[model samples]
Target: MSTSPVTLLTEDDSWEFLRTQSVGRLATAVGGEAEIFPVSFAAGDGVVYFRTRPGTKLVELTVNSRVAFEADEWGEDVATSVVVKGTARILETDAELAAARGTGLVSFQNDDKNVWVSITPTEVSGRRIARG
Candidate 1:
């Protein structure tokens, strides 16, 4: 058990936390502007997968592959957050598509989200905040 109110989680712990969650925010930059979108995601094997339509989110990610993703959960007095700084790429190969599908990622909305995006995290960090 941690004594401190704020506990830093290891990379493995962060990924494990992410695996339990299905929604996150994907942040990207395009033309010096920052864009963030709430996404339904799945995580496995050090990769985060999400489905998106051919729209702003897709275009922005293409222009800037560098991205930051965040997922969090809040309880009565404790909150846990995980941040993943990574490179985002649209899955093109059959293997990549299969892998993304293997994670069982599905769109929360009934949209034609045929495009799959995978974020390979270069750095993953998380923290737990507890109020006493």
Candidate 2:
């Protein structure tokens, strides 16, 4: 009998994997209410960037800056998942806005997504497992 291989990914490895992914779930909690939203994102320089318009997700994160984000991918024989816990804030500075524009993130929604949110991860962890 053969057992599946499991591996823990390093911070750098996790960020590298995250850079290859586009869509992730953004988790936020405020006033004891937890909410999660699917967001298209870009990862670079140890941060995650996503665009959103004024709405629940934006409002929730504003109330509570602490957030959790997750992205995953699966291959024929292996699967991987990355989770990022951090603080999220809206971009305001010109330099910050310029950096975000360079990320080249594309929104899946047709609605105007003019606001950019940057997630600076305090902790990032990931794992990969092989199919048995």
* Stretches of candidate 2 exceeding 4 Å from the true structure: 1-4
Candidate 2 lDDT, 4-108, residue by residue in tens: 499999999999999999999999999898889999999978999999999899989889999999999999999999999999999999999889889888787
Relative to the true structure, candidate 1 has a C-alpha RMSD (angstroms) of: 1.8
- Please give, for residues 43-117, the per-residue lDDT of candidate 1 as tens digits: 989999999989999999888999999999999999999999999999999999999999977678878888999
Error of 1 at 47 (Å): 0.5
CA lDDT of each prediction against the hidden true structure: 0.94, 0.93
Report model 1's TM-score to 2 decimal places: 0.95
The whole-model C-alpha lDDT of candidate 1 against the native structure comes to 0.94
